[model samples]
Target: MNRLLCLLIGLLCISCTSVAQKEKYKKEKVYTVSKTNAEWKEILTSEQYYILRQAGTERPYSSPLNKIYKSGTFHCAACDSPLYESKYKFDSGTGWPSFDRAVEDAVDKDVDYKLGYARSELLCATCGGHLGHVFNDGPRETTGMRHCINGDALVFKHKESKNE
Candidate 1:
């Protein structure tokens, strides 16, 4: 019985070490647009602060950007970093705005175990704001990767027509 107890304690220690390392990495990583929680709250709406700063998700189908099909760029609402082009946007029927791909180097990815499983979490490279997750299931004709993004974490900028 003591041997089994020792093994269990060893497993627990390993798990705790990994969790501490992840927390250390998060605190050490710096973003170009880093700001304090109070400062972020001052600039972002409550929903935006929740989604971007606290990694909270907005309710599905609640974002107007989910249905926007206009020609434009979807930028990080926290830092105005251009992320997804409208050409890559698609209706995944998942309620959130879905994109086939993001603009090159505009976003970063990390593993998320928040839902008790590993998921690819997407973040704004410029600000480290949590945008959403990427999945393997997407249109096969394109990148075959669906970047499921939170519309509340984005700001859509309409592309300018040359007519003006």
Candidate 2:
């Protein structure tokens, strides 16, 4: 009986401490770091700069993926984060680029209700840069998901190409 009382008291104290710690460590959104002009010029192309930094979208049907049928990796232009793979690339006929999945750990999801519909917005995990939105209404047999990405957010890395 003595041991049982001591264990119960110890557990209660631990629980109280945990609750206090949780209350003290409140969560807050940390915005992504802004890049300087020189840093942006060094890392990104002119098109990449307009989209990733200025939140500009590329012209529809202008993406190379509109006709891309090759094998390669797609990476974020701003942060050099590997995003999508060639295997998951599919033609969604959406003008903008599309993917079935992002490279593992490449994307971070958050709530976005931009069009008045609840959506899962994905960002480049490395830089907290916005990538695109994910929807559950995609084709079956897969994840039933579509990662509708902005063409401006990514730069293609073709397997045969020597460009880094």
Candidate 3:
């Protein structure tokens, strides 16, 4: 039927548009810790490679860092650059480890339209590793922003006690 044919055509157009929008931000950049693809593969695990290099996201509420509440710092897994402080972290209940802010000059944000909408995409300023997204919802008493990050992209270091 002509009705069925027209409906199919309309669906196809929508699919094509969505695909095009997703790839709009796929261009590569020169990172501070630039390495050959093979070199990066050797240095990082398979999951880290997928998220940091390919801009993939980890499963929500799946990061051990989400439950971490110790006094310490979180560094980029790729380059070991300090990115966040323990004081800024909070439970946003959005799965990932959410922070109210990053350390000064530690992260660089860019407009990401991968999901067909604009979002603040956070990256490691030192290595350009994709951390996650930042949003406006956060502690009103503090920064009023949430830096939702992937635990796979970070390595947490607990502060040493003076008594020890």
Candidate 4:
């Protein structure tokens, strides 16, 4: 009877450890744009600092970028790294700027459990700033991934046509 109890306790410990590990955020080796907190604060607005530096979420449908469908490249507001091209942008109706994909190698994903649930948190590879979360329920015709990015974390550059 004692042997069976010991085995059960050991199994329980292993499972608990795995769960704890899964909830921890994994850090990347190096970010291209590193800055002090003071420096970042000087450059970013209050809302941008909250969303990017503190990992806070913006209110739904509050961003003007939500309605912009113009052709352009969206770059990280903090570091100016190109994140998503307009070609991959989509209206997911979730009230944030949704994209099917990000530019190749422009972002890194980390496991986040800030809200008591595991989520894929997108970060700027250049500055390690938090962008938002990525979900699986996107357009079936494309990657089927909805990168629900925070607009305060991005700056759009309108691509001018040659017709000018």
Candidate 5:
């Protein structure tokens, strides 16, 4: 009986330690240093509001860019900076929009070692907003690159853009 009780105590200690470690690993620090409430709201749409400002992702297949393949540049919703041009885009089976690369001075790539793996994270240079992840697994004829971006983070401007 005493042995059974000791074993139970040991198990409980181990479980508590594991739980604490998991929490430490998954902790996300939110910064309140940048934009104010009205600034963020004024710069973002409802969907962009949830994703870029709140770190949320849109449901797959819902982005109009999934069907968009025209001559235009995709801009950051927050800053109106050119991100991806229509020329580098391709249909990557991962579902979220894919591009071969980003426009110059548009994306800021940081080495992300999240989830115990090495990856490059894409962000808006101007606002430090999360865009998405980039991968090397792409088509043969293509740049062998995949810039899997979040739809809510982008606002597509058609080629010969009338909105300019």
Candidate 6:
């Protein structure tokens, strides 16, 4: 009766408030390397454009960068900003390249709700390109953060030999 209707209304208000708070955390950021969509498409391949500019995810295990264990820095494909180091990369077996941590100040994070739930979305700090998501379920020994990133968003630059 009246009590039931009041309870339902209260619950609805609570849910709406929570959703608003979550949305507030994902404020849009101005990046150092902003470019028009056409400019981005010109420099990026179709896959890169999709993942970086449009916030699309590449199919897991599709990137050749997954198996690479060489010493190198993973750079953002859009702006060539250094992100994760190879030394921190690990086989999370989730298909995409996983890193325990990112280079300091190299990336930014925001909450994403594309999957009907909140996920910590990682982005290149320089270009604001979507890299992937970060999770707390990572190696407990180190930072305990898994920066699960899309390979199409990164370019690997192998460390140069000192002899060269």
Top candidate by lDDT: 6
lDDT, residue 143, candidate 4: 97
The true-versus-predicted C-alpha distance at residue 80 of model 2, in Å, is 1.2
Which candidate model has the greater lDDT, 3 or 5? 3
Q: What's the TM-score of every candidate structure?
A: 0.88, 0.68, 0.81, 0.87, 0.70, 0.88
Q: Clashing residue pairs, candidate 4? A: none
**Per-candidate total of colliding backbone pairs:** 0, 0, 1, 0, 2, 0
Candidate 2 C-alpha lDDT tens digits along 1-164: 99999999999999999978976896744546456768876787787777765555678788776566578888887877789988887788778778888899888887765678777888888776677788876668787889988887887888875653
For model 4, the stretches where C-alpha displacement exceeds 4 angstroms are: 1-28
Q: lDDT by residue for model 1 over 8-117, one digit each (tens)?
A: 99999999999899788775557899999999999999999999998999999999999998889999999999999999999999999999999999999988889999
List candidate 5 segments past 4 Å from native: 1-34, 111-118, 161-164
Candidate 3 per-residue lDDT, tens place, 3-22, comes to 99999999999999997887
Candidate 4 lDDT, 60-163, residue by residue in tens: 99999988888899999999999999889999999999999999999999888889999999999999999999999999999999999999999999998887
Question: Per-residue lDDT for 1-164 in model 6, tens only?
Answer: 99999999999999999978977895678899999999999999999999998899999999999999888899999999999999999999999999999999999988788999989999999999999999998899998989999999999999987865
Worst 10 residues of 3 by lDDT: 22-31
Model 2, position 164: C-alpha lDDT score: 36
| Candidate 5 residue-wise lDDT, 61-120, digit = tens | 888887788888888887778889988889887779899988887777776655588678
